[model samples]
Target: MASHRVMKIYTVSGCFPLIILLMSTMVIQSTQERTDSIFHYTYCAIHQNIQTDEEMGIADLLSSIAGDIQLRQLDLRSLFPAERFPIQIRFNLKNFDISSDAEYSIAIHEFGVIYEGSCALSGERIVVNDGNGSQRTSASLRPDDTGALFMNFIDIGISLTGQESIVGRSLVIHGNGQSDLEVKYNSTRLACCIIGESDGRSW
Candidate 1:
């Protein structure tokens, strides 16, 4: 019994250092991961798109929590006028080639870009209406009656009432993992604007 006890003690003594070394390695690995995360935040600029509709300021929070990158303070005067395009072309959603005779506008929100279009096309147009007697009939994006589900296209339209509220109507946009968007309408004008926190992701 005494010999067995000595052997057990010997085994424990031999294994204790190994266990401590393993724990030290784990701590080192965790520290390295945190250091790498700090570096990424310090160097990489963050960007977000309106299609996602994610209203969280994760990018700015990351820079703050990481304590590596300096947060830039933008002047309120630098903000774009609501009447003009915040970014050149406004509400930078998916870059699309659309034409309309009516006014068109788009706004960038925390989640995504919301745009209203009421323009007419000459040949092969698609017409979208706001369902408030404001029929935006056009030759653009006129899906056939068969309703062929193109996984790469989406369309939304709203009335341009010179207000941010969508009381008149809204043509909500949804994508099917595809890479196309189309919204064309008639002589009705559309109002576009940008509404979101401009710290991390803007224009």
Candidate 2:
């Protein structure tokens, strides 16, 4: 019994250094992951369409959450030299009164862009809805004739360096009254949100 105990002790002693080394490596890895996250920021924002019906009351808080877009930042310059880094767009918009069959356009505008004004002149259109152009027909996104939508897409070809991140930029969704079949003139701005940065996935 004594011999067995000594052998067991020797085995433990032999593994002591290796165990310590493994623990140290784990700590280093954890720290490096945190550092990497700090350098690569993520962002998200939420907004709702303008309520045209003055007779309508404010929506309940549960429904007022409206829609939100959580962007997963990426560096595509090295992976796809010809393409620009994309913004991952995910949102659940509700209470759309679409009927005219007009198209809606989504775009990212410079910081300080307001929802009441048209930004199509300088805004960068985001590709969404299965390779369709930024502008798409309302009927395509409406949910089962419910006039609501829950859409998600990854918009490519819009380059954004650290100096020009989505955070603080305005994301506008345009509605009816298009000019020349484009959002260039008299396009009704429906909704907008100023994106905000998040530390991790808690946004």
Candidate 3:
């Protein structure tokens, strides 16, 4: 019995270091996975009230159109110009009416104007201007049966690089998919929200 107990203790001791090393490796891997995982931002896009005459900011527009609709889970970081990193946008639409044939586009604005350039992902693309001073076209997006729009794996071309970062920009969903060159800009502004960090808060 004494010899058996000694052998058991020796075996346990011999394996202890290897077990600890494995555990430590697992912990490191978990941390790295979280760090590398794609992070996202959320926004609430609401329809603008036609009765209001006051020029309101994006925040005020959301407040005015409160209780009308809820657009959430927009990935802000994906807008950062990247070639290899494909961006995904997932959002739930609540109390909002969307036609099956109607088209829409997501526009980003910096310094109160649409950013001048374009980005392409996959075979689809979005442009701010067509270089001839014409309104740019937007990528077509469709909603699922659950009223959720999942724009997955969008590869923004080289437009969002260098001096421009999508941070502190305004994102607007327009009706009829009109760009900034619309004759009546405010008529097409469907829902608007300022890009912000993801902190489980609604904007």
Candidate 4:
């Protein structure tokens, strides 16, 4: 009986270290898996109404689209020459799966400028050419109520400039509520509609 008891005590002591090591390894592996889920991207949308320069919980919204894309850093600069308050945006491509044929649209209520020009895709090639080709910026529809809807694609390289503002407004994209954004101004929040998103196949 004395020998058996001594053996049992030694066996439990030897297993304790192995069990702790296994648990530690599992914790590290779980943390790494969670880190991989985050993605990042950089984009600039026109804002209306200067209601408040407050930063909302937009980080979560940003993270949702950025999966595995890390937010390294951003270089924002004002568009020169016209200097009409053009904002150059930079972001990582995260959770949002981007395709070469995909296309997105920006809606402007008033006169604006798209410095880069047209957005086009030929075969597996994506091109952003000058404002001279058939792919020039254009105003597609004119709502009887809203007057007209102007849109254009952004060139990744070209510098875009114009008076784009949606400080207090909302825009619809891919039928997602993300297009709906409101800002408070003049003691009242207003809605400005702008920007649209479409699949790459159409591009």
Candidate 5:
């Protein structure tokens, strides 16, 4: 019995360093995965028919203007696991007309623009509408001269956990200028694209 105990102790001591090395490898892999979990999306083109809305008289003009405008990149980072603060989003536009005074807002929708069903589900808009005045002003839709709109590290006041995650959702860009509200409402949809990974998996 003494000999067996000595053998067991020897085996455990021999394997302890290997076990610790394995655990260290697992921790490193987990840290790498957590660091790389930030989601990325790219909006390429305007898929929907922008000229069909008769209520918006400038549909043709907007469509013509947006024909050259391309959403270059979108990067989204989750600040916390299930918290309602500090969700960072960045977007870059390309070939956009900087001379226009029209401002744009990005929104997350439940259904895609091509989804045919009840108008209720189709039109349900859940945007990052934190009513904090300064926060809202900071998050205001203002693109730079290079056509880059950065929602840099802003607290969007929403939980993006499990079912609340905005992945695989439809993202729409609304054209809102400092003009008539009706005009803004009518010409809201400037571009529409589904948010997906950076691996060209967008719909």
Candidate 6:
């Protein structure tokens, strides 16, 4: 009986670590898979509002069509070691009577200032360029035979998630001849639109 008890004890002790490791892996996978996403923001730019600021004009009329940004990757938002969550930005914009196929850089600014029907930008560029495994900036103005430009960014390296909230900011399009922020009064900025927040059902 003593030998049998000792054998049972040895078997249990030998199996304990394996059981614990399996449990830990299951917990990790469960935590990783439990993430969810929701669309909680909106940014709409219009042609009549933002097109007049350019020197020559990137386009005569530009407006947003069903653009969307979402607050996603719920798992990474809370972590012991902070990590970056994926930001998904989907926007559809059309510029009527565009002149060329030059590429334009898109950036989010710190402020959304609308003055005299034109978007006035201030502060910093919150999200731009490509880095951290995502393409966050630059867009091509693909003009068709009609001389109109159509721009669509669908998961092509743009997202709305940021460490700091980017709501109530400005999305500006910069032309070829200038840095995103130029001079004191930046009249060379091609287009500007205010970023707003909305629920999935409304706006």
Cα displacement (Å) at residue 173, model 5: 1.3
lDDT of 1 by residue, 45-161 (tens): 112122211464321110010001111121233343343111111222322213322222222222223322211111122244544456553322222233221222222342122
Task: Please report, in order, the local distance difference test score of every candidate based on alpha carbons.
Answer: 0.26, 0.50, 0.40, 0.26, 0.47, 0.49
lDDT pick, better of 4 and 5: 5
* Candidate 2 overall lDDT versus native: 0.50
Using lDDT, rank the candidates from best to worst: 2, 6, 5, 3, 4, 1
Estimated TM-score for each candidate: 0.17, 0.49, 0.44, 0.19, 0.49, 0.50
In terms of TM-score, the best-performing candidate is 6
In the order shown, the candidates' Cα RMSDs to the true structure are 20.6, 10.3, 11.9, 18.6, 10.9, 13.4
Clashes of each: 17, 0, 0, 26, 0, 3
In model 6, the Cα lDDT at residue 75 comes to 33
Tens digits of per-residue lDDT, candidate 5, 1-203, equal: 11111222245678888876876687777765554444333333334424434575443333222321122222343455434434445454443446668666666667655432111233557655564743221124566687655334444543343555555556566666443432644545555566544543331
**lDDT score, candidate 5:** 0.47
In terms of TM-score, which candidate is stronger, 1 or 6? 6
Query: Which residue pairs show backbone clashes in model 5?
Result: none
The sequence of per-residue lDDT tens digits that candidate 2 reaches over residues 30-84 is 7766554533344545454333223564321111224665565565555555544
Q: Model 4: residues >4 Å from true position, as ranges?
A: 1-64, 67-89, 97-130, 136-161, 164-203
By TM-score, the better pick of 1 and 4 is: 4
Highest-scoring model, lDDT: 2
